[model samples]
Target chain A: MSGFLDILYFIVPISIAYAAPLIFTAIGGVFSERSGVINIGLEGLMVMGAFVGIVFNLFFVDTFGDWTPWVSILVAMLVSAIFSLMHAVASISFRADQVVSGVAINLLGIAIALFSVKMIYGKGQTDFIQEKIPRFNIPFLQDIPVIGPMFFKSVYGSSILAVAIAILAWFIIFKTPFGLRLRSVGEHPMAADTMGIKVNRIRYIAVIISGGLAGMGGAVYAQTMTNDFGHATINGQGFMALAAMIFGKWHPIGAMGAALFFGFAQALAISSSGIPFMQNVPSVFLYILPYALTIIALAGFIGKANGPKALGDPYIKGSR
Target chain B: MSNRLINVLVPVISIILGLLVGAVVMLVSGYDPIAGYIALWNGIFGDSYAIGETIRQISPYILAGLAVAFAFRTGLFNIGVEGQLIVGWFAAAYVGMAFELPKIIHLPLALLAAAAAGAIWGLIPGLLKATLKVHEVIVTIMMNYIALHLVNALIKVVAKGGFKTDKIQDTASLRSDFLSELTDFSTLHYGIFVALFMVFIMWFILERMKLGYELKSVGFNENAAQYAGMSVKKNIVMAMVISGAFAGLGGAMEALGTFGNMSTRAGFTGIGFDGIAVALLGANTPLGVVFGASLFGSLKYGANNMPNAANIPIEIVSIVIALIIFFVACGYIIRVGLQRIGKNKEAK
Candidate 1:
């Protein structure tokens, strides 16, 4: 029984590592959609963040040493925010189709990132980072019983950070005055605008924040999940975060829970060989599990789980 | 300018702006823009072989673009075109290799199988949207990954050889020796004609049929369409099914004509994603997709030769393609800007 428990313990910490990025990105999605901007560019934004984060780490690690990954995380957020301004300008200012603008951002982000990689390294991939963000065991928490070893013995700081951010996000979104204005704009842009809220400006800020957070999510995925940056490093994680956002009913704390669930699913896929019952199962089924679950969850819960009222609509000053 | 003329100018202007962005990237990167452009042009159009290759590359893109455009016209986003295309590619390869029949029967059968596979894949998201009110965008994106992993697994189970299947039977192939000879041994095939035929089919359905009007009406205003006694849900499903058919044919073009073999993939083909840009550039019209696909194909095919000849990374071409879509997505802004300029000139 302890042996079985041991395997579970091993998988728990690894799963949290996978959950970190999803939590951050889902929170990002929540922020954007709550303000009426549907940021389908989350995937692309994640790619930009991952690429810049890894590139920054590779080039600047000598100067910053152990502080390199954290600095790179900040840089990635700024870069991704700047990059997402294109979508903001197109969707909010120019009144271009939001979905179309998002698709364009997705394309441009990956393309520019890969192009720059080639220009800098004369190759399509960035150099692998030698040092990663440090992980730790909680000093007092690890001293407890069965729960302690499974939860706190070996924990990634990034996962802890994701949970903290999700809580902070929930507080900001549900309990703050700014959140009230943001939700008002998403619910009724005309009413919000008439009542002195700057609808477009609020949308721009929300989208920019989404991009920055998504960039950090991507950076965490790179720094913790993978050591190198390439075109494939951030694949599907952003989309999965969107799935988590939807599954969570657009709530930050709920999104973190969904992310944890997905991260567990991923961990099972990766660590199935060590688990007794899962050894004979084909890995393909494991691979398809999360996506299939997302589809089912969306189909099952969407009718009850309403999104922001003006989610995909641009705020026209005179429009009904 | 007339609305039609302004509509026509959007893509043309965006293409120029996209190219200018490419030039800036090139200049900043310290490569000679003139030499790079010349190499790209020569690679695409300077020779018969190059032109043939370009056309060969474009045939699938046209079909993929049509897939995206058709759905766009019906107010549906078909991000799963990549998934549909891959499943279709696998189905075509499977039927081509697994069957024994005359050339006349075998070829069309494989293509039909591909179309069916793609249609079934597309139908799921369509049904989800109609029945559950789940957003098709989210469903399609999820379905793409599901299709990718499931098909990769299925291929491993079905294929006799290692990672790739055997060469497709000649009777099941789309390659035409006559065209290959005409194009100086390029891989150009009968797929081009089929692609043109599909364009006509899309045009006929959208322009001449009552069903087309219904689809467009639903796209323009679903509530209004429902008020007019049309089944909005059915039209939505039908549009996705039809859009998927186009993507299936594109996969057949690649499997039967270009590659003639299927290999396992760990990632998406990206042809479907590129199709989004093509559809946008083409203004969601069948005829426009042809021009859009042509430019996209020529740039992509031409870029393959640039790394060796011009010392420019091929990713620069992707940047250009992406920028084109970006500028084109911002087409409304450009249109308003243009109209303002025209008014200023009129005042002068």
Candidate 2:
């Protein structure tokens, strides 16, 4: 019985690590979508950030060694922000179709990152990181029974950060004037514009913020979870985050809940192999649980999840 | 008169600019960009073999691009082409493995099954969009994942411990090795002929058929189309079915002619998504899709050779393609450059 409990303990922490990257990204989607820019490029941006973060961490660790994670995380955020500026230029400035422009950004991001990584590394993947984040047991609290180990003892620093960021994201999305304006733009940009808000500028800010957070998510995944970078490392995580965002009904807290649920499903899928009854079930089915859940969520099985009214519609000045 | 010439020349000029950018990247990386481009050109068009490879690559693009282009003409975004392609691939492959019959019947039967499979895959999004007013983009994106996992599950069940299916029967297979004997084993098959036929059929259907007119009218404006007595819902669903059928045929070509079996590789083949770029670049016309697919195929085939010859990564080709798409989509940037050129000419 304790052995079963031990397995459960192992599953929760590892699952949370996998969920951390997605939580940040889903929150990023919340910011972008709330501001009415449908950022399909979130996937591409996360991929870019994953590559840059790992590469930066590699070099920084080669030199500074100890301060590598902080340096690499900052560099990843900066790179993602710079990368997202292209989407801003295309969608916000040029007034192109937000979805199409986002797709272009995604294509450009992946192409550029993969091309450069191949040029520098001589392959499509990067060398594994020598230094990786290890499990940290919190002082005093780790000694508690049952829930304590699952919450703090077995959890990664990045997982803790994801939860903290979720709270901060909730505060920002609901408690701030900027958040109100962002939601106003997404819900009705023309109304916000008439109210003297700089709609496009706000949208740009939202997109950039999204990119930065997603970059951090990528960095955390690299530094904490995988400790390596490859062309396929960020495969569909961004899309999964998008699904989570939709599943959670586009709210930050809701998205975090959805992310955790997805993370648990993934963890359960993998960990279930150890359970006697589920031993025969193929593990691949769990790999697709999040996506399956997304369809179910969208099909009205989860009730009506309304996106922002002005989502995906490009804003044109002086148009009705 | 010359100014009008420049307007037509701009897309060509953009292509040149994209190539030059690719060239500059190659030079910076210590490879001869000119040699790389030359090698790419040769690999795609230099000999009968290379040309056949190019055509082989373009076969699916022609169909997938048509899939996307057809939907676009109906004012629908069939982002589910990837899903449709997978279902079509599995359908064709399953039929190929399940039956043994005369070539006269098996080949056409497999092809038709592939088309019907794609059509069924496409119908889900069409129904949702037409009835529930759900966005096709989201539904299509979701369907891609569904198709991937569902097929993967099916493959696991039917493949009997192997990741791939058994080799398709000779009756079901569409090999061109015999034709290759005449053309020095160029690897081109009857698929190219089929693809070309599709181009003609698509052109005829979109131009001559009343249903096609309704689809186009709906694309332009649903209100106007409905006022013109066209059923928007029916056309939307029909457009998706036709698009799905095209993608299905594309998958059949790949399964029967190329891979000869169904297997998972890296998640999903990007060919269907790449069709989006091709259709957009080709301006979504049948002839244009062929041209765009050929261009893209040439670049991809060349990129594979570049790593061996120039020591440059194959991913740069994707970069070049992306850049070209970016430049073309930002038509205002080109117009601005053209305007400045005209002003300079006037001053002279």
Candidate 3:
């Protein structure tokens, strides 16, 4: 029984912490992809967010006190949303190939961030932040017999916020009129345009929203996990979130599930040394498991994970 | 203006604009743009040593650019070039270390091993795309991480838990003593010949072969290709295989010429990612890729001098490259701006 409790204590917080960032980012991917703009630049946008978040926290830790991380996250989201305008202007207004533009975004994002870091800090990376987002147990839920200890104990506020946002995202995407317009534009922009809906406007908003959420996700990860910003802080997490977005078939709740699964895989890989039975297994196997599993999941096990019909196609004014 | 002139003009304009923006960024950050540019120029062509090293650095970029350009020409995006390159690096290193043969046999055998490894890596996503209708982009992205971790593990195993493998035997090396002597002992090697040959091969296949027609048609439209009695799946797989081989040869360039050994990477080397920009700047053409690779290689190699000479970060080059890609993607804007300028000049 103690062994089970020990495993729970080890696995629960780690997995949730890992999953929270992905959940936010994957849901962001869903919004953009569903609105017909392929956002391969999420990684770049996340990098910008992580950079901004760390810079803000380091500069204003005393002023914001305990609220530093949260404020930094908000600042990151705003900055990233503005940064994504470059992608929207290129891909949407200029009718650029979305993927190419996205690739440029990724490159520009990292280049600008690192260049600024070097200029400001006189180094490759920033100083570690003293304050981080705090984690705590729920008031009454931690007292429950078995479930409480596994789920509610030692939980990050950001983790809970991520799950709550996922639910809210589901409602927004599936239930709201704005969601209907967004999906319609993604499915058939021509049809949406005929219905008097502004296709480019919707796509711009969607991309901005995606940028904001991904930025928030990056900040959360930086503040809670790394406690600082560097080149490696947000490495490939955006891509993993992208995989989760696809693996979840672009559904918000489904993306959350996939993120949690990937998070579990990541947590297992990181914590394998502590587990007695799994100690003999090669770390490589654990490391590659999530990626290999994503490939397997995509190759017919999921039965055609079709994206929005017009996902990569830019909507022109009149040309079919 | 002639179509060919316009084609040349667009890239030239983009490059100039990219550099201008980079200059502006430097100025905004309180750095001397003139000094930075001067430092950059000196770094690239200061002496024979810098020239030789820059050319050597360009060799792999040429192949990596070809890999991306070939895929783009065939309507595929092989984002897995990084993964293919990784596996190829391992394969070449493995053969070079484990085998004993004459120089001629050893070098080609190592190159072939690298190509085969990259081909296999590319084949997985191609097969999945053809058979299961899975998107190649996500699959290739996944393959990258798989290759990174898998190769790292394999390196540890082969090196007895060390980060790098033993250096290759002399027989397998691409080092050219005469070239090195001419360039003041720079790391220039015979890999440039291999890169040039592959460029020619890409040109011949894409522009002069029947198979190229099929591949291009398949890329243009799978349904149309299928209707024309061509096997879409076969062409897709074949395109990826050929592209992967080019990328793998890029890895061999590093293993056999530049580094002479493979080490576990903390993260991606950014060579493959940079290949995307190279391909774009080159307009996805064979000869264009060479020029693009040269420009990129020069900038990247010269960037090392920025810290000491001008107090600028090496990432400034990356920013310039990114801006170039952005301008290329938004060529419509440039074209419109140019046309407006032309009209205004006529009125004046």
List ranges where model 2 is wrong by over 4 Å. A1-4, A280-284, B1-14, B332-348
Top lDDT prediction, candidate number: 3
**lDDT comparing candidate 2 with the true structure:** 0.82
Candidate 3 lDDT tens digits, B225-316: 89999998888899999988998999999998888889998778788888888888898999999999999999999888898999899899
Cα RMSDs, all models = 1.5, 2.4, 1.5
Which RMSD does model 1 reach against the true structure? 1.5
- Clash count (model 1, backbone only): 0
Model 3 misplaced regions, further than 4 Å: B339-348
lDDT of 3 by residue, A1-320 (tens): 78867887789779999999999999999999999999989999889988999999999999999999899999999999999999989988998888888888888988999999999999989999998988889989999988788789889889999999999999999999899999999999999999999999999999999999999999999998998777788888888998889888899999999999989888988888898887899888878877887788788686667889999888989898
Task: Report the first chain's TM-score for all candidates.
Answer: 0.96, 0.95, 0.97
Query: Over all chains combined, what TM-score does candidate 2 have?
Result: 0.94
Q: What's the CA error at residue A153 for candidate 1, in Å?
A: 2.4
- How displaced is residue A296 in candidate 3, in Å? 2.4
Prediction-by-prediction clash tally: 0, 0, 0
C-alpha DockQ for predicted model 3? 0.78
* Model 2's DockQ score: 0.54
